[model samples]
Target: MNFEYSFEKISCKDVENFEKIRNVTLPYDYKQFLLLNNGGKPIKRRFQSKDGKITSSLMMYFPISESVEISLDEKYKIYSIGKIVPSNFLPIGIDPADSLICLSVSGNDIGKVYFCDMDYFEEDNELKKEFISLISNSFTEFTGSLYIPE
Candidate 1:
């Protein structure tokens, strides 16, 4: 089954340009998602951490748009002068508490999915595992794990 989302479309060129500017490669599952749907609300909104310590809904995926609000660049400001989002992480979506769901784009953890607990976001400029929990090894696993909470 495919993940169901609704949004305007962006071409592979858009993803390519963004990837080039960031000098990073998006995970196959996520890259495909961006190409196909751009981004919107997921059919199954709720998900839990692998350790089961966190459960939240996926409000939306950051679409590749010029709009300041929903653009991937706006949420992350990938190369902006003043940004607090962790290095090597892309803010993909958000949970109710405003915590970000991120994808690791580079280094050994590349392609990993994480639950970025914002309460711990300001404590360190660098991402710390204690606060950022590994939700899945890959974006595919991450989406597969999403479920609608009763």
Candidate 2:
């Protein structure tokens, strides 16, 4: 739950502004994380499936700079447009391969983290639950799951 390289610290007000503009209620733990580190490179960057049969490495957590100033790629809104990312889900980070690391913002799955593989779809093009892999049941768990790859 630590980042060796992180953006400038942000206040709770900044997080509130972000949520208001984005129209989504962020998880409390995630909001606290934002206040600690807006975004950055994690110390432990890898995580794996339950059986360790599948593994993925994180690139960076997307900054909460939408309320400030940043590029489209750095902002979560760009990926959420046109429902490309799916409703009630937001891009919070990315894997090394540029796939999305998402967070659920509504329903019973609120605060849960998921992986959206960019190269999974063949046709249909619509994002579905089957295509999204549940990484953890909460943002705290997701951050806690990060580990150093062997």
> Pick by TM-score: which candidate is best?
1
Tens-digit lDDT track for model 2 on 1-150? 667787877788878887787788999998888788777889898987554545798888878664534422344656675466777787888787878888888888899888887777445455765667888889889888999977
Q: What lDDT score belongs to each candidate, Candidate 1 first?
A: 0.79, 0.76
lDDT of 2 at 135: 86
Q: Quote the lDDT for 38 in model 2.
A: 76
Model 1 pairs in collision: none
Residue 6 in candidate 1 has what lDDT? 65
TM-score of each: 0.87, 0.86
TM-score of 2: 0.86
Which stretches of candidate 2 lie above 4 Å from their native place?
50-53, 66-74, 121-124
